[model samples]
Each structure stands twice: as C-alpha cells, then as structure tokens.
Target: MSPHAELVSRLRAAWLSGKTRPMEYRLAQLEALGRFLDEKKQDILEATAADMRKPPFEVEVSELSICRSELNHTLNNLGAWMKDKHVEKNWATQLDSAFIRKDPYGVVLIIGPWNYPINLLLVPLIGAIAAGNCVVMKPSEITRNVERLVAETLPRYLDEDCFAVVTAGVEETTRLLENKFDYIFFTGSPSVGRIVMTAAAKHLTPVTLELGGKNPCYVSDSCNVQNVARRVAWGRFFNAGQTCVAPDYVLCSVEMQEKLLPALREAITEFYSPNPRESPDFGRIVGDRQFQRVQALLHSGHTAIGGQTDAGERYIAPTVLVEVQQDDPVMQEEIFGPILPILTVASVDDAIAFINARERPLVLYVFSSRKEVVKRVLERTSSGGFCANDTIMHMTIPSLPFGGIGQSGLGRYHGRSSFETFSHQRSALLRGAGRETLNTPRYPPYAPHRLPLLRAATETKRRATCLLL
Candidate 1:
C-alpha cells in the first residue's frame, strides 16, 4: 500500500467505529491536546527558533498563546457548539422538531503552513477534534525543526487512533493528496491550493483553502503618519514578512509617502533597533531559497531605508522602498519578507482603483482617522477582511472569521467559524405518528382544492404565514 493509503484506511476504520461521536470523548481528547501544549511549550519555542530564528516572544504570542486561546475557547464552548441548533420552522413543520445537526466529515486532512506552524496546525485541529473527526495533520516540511518536533511529540498526548500528525515534503505531500479524504483543509500559497483542489475534485471532496495574496495597505493623507507607519511596520515585519495577512505593499499619495518614509524608518528602528541584524526580536527568512526570492525583490524600487541582506544567515533587514510603480517586481506578487514598497496614488479613488485592478487580497488595510475615508475604502474594495486604522490586529479577535475571497482563499476558520468549517450541517425534521392527519394536504392526490391547503401548510411569507391546513 502507498504511504498515505494505509494511514487513511486506519483512520477511516477508527472513524467508522463511532468512538469519536460522543461529546465526552471529544472533550477528553481536546483536554489531552491542551496538556500537550502546556508540556511541550519550551520545545515548541526552541524548534521554531532553530528552524527560522523565530523570536521567543513571537513564538509565545503568535504560536503558543493563540493555540492555547483556541484550546481553552474550544474546551469552554464545545458542549454548546456540539448541541443540535434548533431552527425556526415553517407552518408545514411547525409541529415537528426541526434542527441543524453539526456532524463531522468522517476522516479529514489538515495541511499546515510554515509560517506560524503551531498555531495554524493546531487551531484547525482543535475544531476538527471538537467536531469529532478522525484527523491526519501534515505540518509544513519547510520548517524542519518544528515539523520534527511535532512528529515526535504531538501523538503521545492524544488518542493515537483518532488523531495523527504526519511529516511530508513536496513529493510526499503530492502523493499523500492522492488518497481520499472526507474534507481537506489547506493553508498555503495559491499555486499549491489549486493542486490540492484539483486532487480533491476527483472524489468531489469538500475543501477549505486559506491562501495568501498581495494584501494592500492604503494610507490616507488624513491619517497619523507615525501611527500608520508603526502599525504597518508591525504587520509587515512580523514573522519576517512571512505572514499571509500581512500588508503586502502600501498605497498612498506622493505627499503621504514622503511624510511616511522617515516615520517608517523610525518605527523599524524602534521595533528592531538601528541594527536589526543584531536585534534578538528580529527573525530570519525560513529558508535560503525563500531568502533569495525575497532578497531579489529589493531591487524593485529605490531603497528608502534599511535594505541590508546577509545571505549566510538568510537575514534581510527591515527595508522600505519608495518610488515603486504598480508594475514593479515587488507589486507583482505577495512580498513575504521584510520589504515594504510604497506606491503613490493621486487620491483615495486612485488607491481604490489600484486595489480593484488587481486580484482581491486576503485583507485590505486603510489608515485614516476620518471615518468617511475609512468607510469609503471599505465600501469600494473587495478583500477577505478589512482593518480601518490598524493591521493584523483584526485577526486577534476570536469572534471574527479569518479567511479570504477569490485568489486570496476560500472558506473561513477561527473560533465558531473553525468549528463550522469542519462540520457538515445536517438539516432534520421529526414528526410524530399523530401528524399524519396534517399531511392530508399533499397525499399525492392532484386536485384544485388541495392546492390552497398545501400552500397554507407550507406558507412561510411574513404577511401570509398559515399554521393550519
């Protein structure tokens, strides 16, 4: 058998046993996962740091804490989330019990990304486990240290029968996708997302793709320059600009761009110090190839600030580029590095036009103290999410859904959205044996008199609701 075939078969058998269906079973498993996090905290920090020089604070906030929040939130709410949601009924089903049952999609595959490996892998896993599905989680092989750590450690805490973590590189991952899954949740680039989707199409399997695109940050002239610079710098430079939701590039008027350049430099210095390479808080690109790709993008426009690169360490200092054009290399793709390109627009309309001209981003950012400008940008452009005066802080809210639209990605997951994504909503209605008399309106006897009763029985219109036949 193929590498994945046997594993899929094993998980499928476990799922068929119906052991994962009970609320108690799910809670127990989730609690075990929480224990894993608490026990493995130091190891995770070390692994991420070894893999990409991910700062300890960054790992704590983005990796460890986000996951714990997801875990605790799931633990606190799983009972309620699993309960059948009773929905309102039409006249035809008024006497019946009608509800939407959230059910697991049998065996599922969760493919994680390199950036924020722990959070991305486990957050979705939390939902899948809560929804009671046997899951096979594949963390990105790019972050080798973390991948190895997860492969070695994660399965010990959870029931080995219900959940398993697999480590695979590009070829192995492609082979793994050949096997069928009830649902596939992929977090990666758009190109790989297409491949996963195409593979899923053979089985007509459902998929949720969390993809990345060129997220544009539009800075209005009315905004505070320092605030905008600091916020954008934080979002873009976090994870060394490897974040999917990070601001890809900036759009502002020439005047604002000029005013913002010095401020951005000051923000970078404040956050990472004058010598970012020496700063412990700064991170390196995940891999040498990624470093080279990001390094090449620096030439897209004149370097306005720090553009230092150290190939040996795979480190690129927090850099800013001004006089960038729409057709520049930096604007051509998602800049997943510590390089920020500023392109000037004539006005907010021009900025909106520039944004609309390209594919929809994962998120659209507009920094303006004025409500009208913020509202105008929110109304005109299309993106997965929006932040008025901030950056990635919007994603910190568990209540909000984090996903994309169009080229950015498909479907959403976070908090309740995560649970909903992994679950299949099964609509059901129960009728009592005594209710047969109420079904007399249909009876398959085609007649003019029956039409009125049938309409009355099924009426759902606000002004014309009828509860009797």
Candidate 2:
C-alpha cells in the first residue's frame, strides 16, 4: 500500500481500537496540543517570519494565541460537549428515553490555508480531537518553514497512531484527497473548496469549507470618520491584508469617501509611519506569485495613499485606491494582499444595492452611529457575519459561530460550534421491553376505532401539558 493509504489505515486502526474515544484520552491530547503551542512559541514566531516576514507580535497574537485559546477552551468543555444531550419528546415518545449521542466520525482530514497556517490548522484539529476522531493534517506547503516545523514537531506532542501531519504541495494534496475520510475540514479559496467537496462526494464524505470572499465594508455618513478609518485600516492591513475575512473593498457615499480618505491617510501614517515598507510591524506578501498578483492590482484605481513595491522583498505598501470602478480587476476577486479599494455610491440604499450585486461576502461591516442605519443594512443584506461600526471583531467571540453563507463558504466552527461540527449527533431512543403496550399504536393491524384513539392521544395542541406514559 502507498504511504498515505498506510497512514490512514494506521489511524483508522487506532480509532477502531477505541483509544481516542475516552474523555480522559481526549483531554490528554488537548493538553498536549496546548503544551505544544506554549513550548514552541519562539519556533512558531521564527518560522512564520521566515515564511512571510510575518511580525513576531502578529504571529503571537493571530496564530499562537488563537490556537492556545481554542485548545484551552476545548479542554475545559470537552466533557460537557461529549455528554449525551437529552432532547424533549412528544407524547408519542414519552415512554422512551430520547437523546443525541455525540459520536466521532472515525477519522478526519484537515487541509489548512497558507495564511494563519498554524491557527487555521490547529484550531480545527482541537475540535476533531475533542470529538474523539483520528486526524491527518495537511498543512499548506506554500508556508514551508511553518509547515516543516509542524510536520516535525507536532507529531511528537500527539499520538503518532492517532494523528499525523503530511507536508506536500499540489500534487500530493490532490492524491491525499483521493482517499476516504469520515470528515474533511478545508480552509482556502472557493475554487479549491469546490474541488474538495467534489472529491468528498465520491466517498459520500462530509466536509466543512472555510473559504474566502470579497468582504465589503460600508461606511455611512452618520459615523465617526476618524474611528472608522482606524478600525478599517487595522482590519484591512492586518497580516498584510491576507486574512480571509479582511474587508476586500469599501462602499460609501462620495461625501463619506472624501472625509474617509484624509482620515485613512492619517491612520495609515500613525499605524505604519511615513514609510510602511520599512516598518517591522508590517508584513510582506507571502511569495513572488502573490506579490505579482497584488502588484497588478495597484494599477486598478488611482492610488490615493501608499503604493510602493519591492520585488526582492515581496513588499507591497499598505495601499488605498479611490475612484475604483465596480468591474475593475481589483474589485473582481478577493484581494489577498495589502490593497484596499473604495468605491463611491450615492446613498445607503445604493451601497446596499452595490453589495447585493456581488457575491455574498464572508463578512459585512457597517460604520455608523445610528442604530437604525446599521439595522437597515443588517436587515437587507446576507453575509457569513456582520459587524456594526467595527471590523473582524465578530469572529473574536467564541460563543458566536464563524462561517460564510452562499458563495463565501460552508459550515462553521469555534467554541461549541467547532465541537458540534466534528461530531455527529446520533439520535437515540431507549425503552423498556415492558413498553410493548405503548408501542402497539405504531404497529400495523390498524382498526378504525383504534385510529381515532391513537390520533387523539398523539395529537398536539396549541396549549398542552406533557402526558405521562
């Protein structure tokens, strides 16, 4: 057998042996993952910096800290999340005990993206572990340093029989997806998401796709321009704007655009200084291909602010483009770099229409002080998540589910949502053998008189009390 097949067989054997199903075992794995994060903080920081010139502080906050939080949260709540959830039943099922048993889908495959490699990969691994499933993690090969670190060090902290990291590029990933898995969790582009879903369909396997979109930021005239500029700049330029949920473009009135431009310029200067390319806090494009793609976009609209580039360093300055047309190349796809485009609209209704005309975004942001204006936008549009007067903060709350709608992506994971995503809620009904009389109504051999009596007994009322068996 091939190495990948053999590896999957080994994990399946471990899962079948029931080693990963125990609560104690799950807790141990989660704790080990937490320790892995804590022990390898410096290594992770250095690797990310090597991969993308990612700032050490940014790596710590966005990558290591987030993974640690997910691990800790899973550890604290694994038992409760794993417990059988009892569900209410009607009079028909009152005689039987009905509950949802959280069952792990034997073995899982997690394919992570290059951006935020560690966090995106490990966070879902935490869920798969908490759900008591064996995992095969495929870290993106584009981030070679981080991928190598994970492939070498991560297995030492995990049970080799239950978890393994496979490092490969496109060819290997395509082959790896050919194998059968109980579940697949992938985070990347929508085009690749379709490929993963298609491959999973062959095995009738389930999948969770955390894909990307051109997230829209709508700035209404009723809000604070300075605050809006600061928040928008932070969200748009964080990780050099490689985040999947980063605001792809801004939609606002011409008046608001005029006010926002100067405020945004000031915010950019305050955040990254006059020369952002030289700022240590700022990150570079991940590779030459990405650099070239973003370089081509700088010509889309008139550059209002920073528009510097260095091919050797893969540096694209934190740039803002104004007077952008809707059909421009920059507006066409998810600008996965440090480029922010602002498109002018006439009014709030026009902004909503402009957003609605495009694909559904992963996130929609509205900067407005008026609750009614925010409410109007929220009511009209659909997105994976929404933030009023802010950006990217909605995803920070673990209690809220994080996933896209329609074209953006499918499924959600974070906190309980993560655990639930990796779990199959098996509906169970248990009853005593002596309850034969109660089940008589459901059996065949129907009589006319019995039909009326059964209907009356099982029929639901507008205002009804629970009936005793």
Candidate 3:
C-alpha cells in the first residue's frame, strides 16, 4: 500500500479511538515537534540547500528561523489562545454570559509550496497542532531533498497517528484530496489554487489559499532613491525572486527610473558582486523549466543592465530591464526570477490606476517619503499587505495577518490569525436561574405594551449588580 494510504488509515484509526481528544495531548505533541526541529536544525538547513541551491545562511534565516519563531510564539501563547475570551453581552442577551470557545477541526491538509518549503510547511503545522487538529502535510515534491527529509524525519519525532507526510506528485495529491478533510491550507500560485478550491468544493471543505500575484513596488520622486533601490534589489533577487511576495515589477517616473536602475545595479554588484552566478550568496532558478521561462521574459525587453545566463548551471544573473510596456509578455505574468522590469508612469495616480486595473496583489510596496502619498496608495489599492519606503518587511510583523485578496488569494494566517484559522470559534451563553426579567418579555407573547419596555431596556446600559439585603 502507498505511504499516504497507510498514513490515512492510521490517522483514521486514531481519530476513531478518540486518542486526539485532549488538548493537553495536542499541546504535548506541539512541544515535541518544536524540539524536534530545534535538534534537527543543521539537517533541515542542509537538505533545503541541496534541493534549491540556497546558501546555508539564507536557509537558516529565511526558513528555519521563521519556523522556529512561529513554533515558539504559538507554544508560548497557546494557553491564552485556547482560553474562552469574554465578550460584551448586549442588553437583549443581558441574562447570559458570552464567550468564544476554540474547537479543533478534525483533519486538516496543508499543501506547502516549493519556495521556503520548511517555513510554509512548519508554520502552518504549528497552527494545526496548536489548535488540536490532526494534519496531513503535503510538502512540495519539487523540493525533493526537503521532501525526503520531512517524510523520513517527521514520523521519528512526531506522533505518527496525529500527523503524516504525504509525498507524491499530482496523482497522489488528486487521490488524497478525494478524501474529505475538515480544512485545506494551500500556498502556491493562483492557477493551482483554483484547482484546489474546485476540488475542495466537492466536500465543502473550508480553504485557506495563500496564493501569489504580481506584487508591484512603486518608487516615488520624494523618496531617497538609493535606499529604495537597495531595498528593491534585495527583494527582487532574494531566493532568486522565487518569493511569492517579492516585488515582481517596478513603477516609477522617467527621472526616477533612470536614477533607480543604476542604483539598483550598484546594489546588486555590492550584494552579489559582478559575477552573480559565481557568488556564493546568490541563488539559481529551481530547474530548467523555470530557467527557460525567465529567459523568455528577458527576450521581451530592452535590457538596461546584466542580462546574462548559464542554462546548464540554471543561473540567471541579477538583471534590470527598462522601457517595458504594459503589453509586454514580461508584464503578462509573474516573472519569478532575478529579473526587474521598470515601467515608467507620469504620476503616482497613474501608477495607482495601472495597478488597480489588474488583479489585487499579495503586497504593494510604496517607496515614498511623503506620508500622505503613502496613505493614499494604501487607501486606494487593496493588497493583502503594504510596506512604505521598503519591501517585504511587513511580512516580518507577526501581528499582521499575511495572506492575499481577490486573484492574489483568499484568507489570512499568521500568529493569532493562524490559531483562529485552524480553530473554530464556537460561542456560548449561560444564564443564572434568578435573572429572568429580560427572558419573560422576550418569550411567547408579542404585546404592544412590552415593545416599549423592551426598547427602553435594550437602549440603556445595565446598572451595577447589588446583592439582596
């Protein structure tokens, strides 16, 4: 039998046996999982590097550190998060006490993307475990090294009956999704997200899709040009710009574009040196298919600086293209590689209009010194998140919910948001036996005389509680 099938059977048996009922047991499992990752840090980093040619430090910083932080934060806050929160009770329901109870959904499926495999997978896993739900983690098969490690190491460190790793390509995922799940959490492209949602519709499973769109970075005239370039350069080429939240394209005035491109080129040279492919810090496109796709994008533009390639090595240099039009193929889809296309606009309003015409993005970055302009952009454009005078740093804030809107994706999850997403907020109301004054009028008889009393009672606040003398 397949590994996924075996895992499903085992988890189903455990679920039927009621072994996953207690919150204490689930919390214990979460604590153990965190420790497992802590102990296997080196192994995890090495595996991720082998699969994606990522530098060890990059793997540690971008993937491992974030995962550890998320796990630790969830562990620290789980007790408080699980406690029923008290809410203000209305006069209409004044006789009752109101609070929200967090309940676990039965089984969940987390479909992680290839980029930042460990971060996307482990962070969501933290939520599912914290919320006391059994999980089926389908790590991207494209990250072969990390997938192998997760499939092998997880069972050793975690409760096999509570969490399982299902490793396969499309066919395995298809068969697995055929089974009913309480929730589905997916992070990848919108194209694939549509398919996931359509499949999920079969079972009416709630879905959390963290999908990607072309996240645009706008460079305004009032901004510090050099700082904007440095930030954009880092975001554009990080993870070879395979990041879903990476700045896909740039919009600026003619003067800003001219000044910005050179600054960006300088930043790239400083960050990765002239020969980026040979630099240990730089990354490559994941495979030949990605390399070809990026190469095709380069062919569509007037290359301003550094349009070079090494197909055999899967290397595409940090490139900058200028004078790109709205109709260019590079503009047609997401350029998920180390390529930056500068689209010039006359004014910020024009830039806003251009962005508004397309699908809402995952993030909109505004590099402007003027607070009013930044505020206007934020008000006008609807992205999952925004950053001013910077790019991608908004994702670092654990307080902010990180996800997308419209074509970018649906639902948000991070820290408290993740806990809420994984858990169902069931509400309850309890009343005392003696406080029956409000209930008497609300029951059976709909009298004209009782209407004024009900209205007056609801409009006013309750007085202080007093004990009988």
Model 3 segments beyond 4 Å from truth? Answer: 1-6, 9-23, 432-448, 451-469
Candidate 2: give the clashing pairs.
Answer: none
> How many residue pairs clash in each candidate at the backbone level?
0, 0, 0
- Model 2 C-alpha lDDT per residue in residues 85-199, reported as the tens digit of each score: 8987777778779999999999999999999999999999999999999999999999999999999999999999999999878988889989899999999999999999999
**What do the candidate models score in CA lDDT, each in turn?**
0.92, 0.91, 0.86
Q: What is the lDDT of residue 186 in candidate 1?
A: 98
All candidates: TM-score: 0.97, 0.97, 0.93
lDDT of 3 by residue, 158-276 (tens): 88877888887998898888777889999998888999999999999999999988999888999888898899999889888889889999999999987887899899999999888
Per-residue lDDT, model 2, residue 366, is 91
Q: How far off is residue 258 in model 1, in Å?
A: 1.6
Cα-based lDDT at residue 336, candidate 3 = 88
Better of 2 and 3 by TM-score: 2
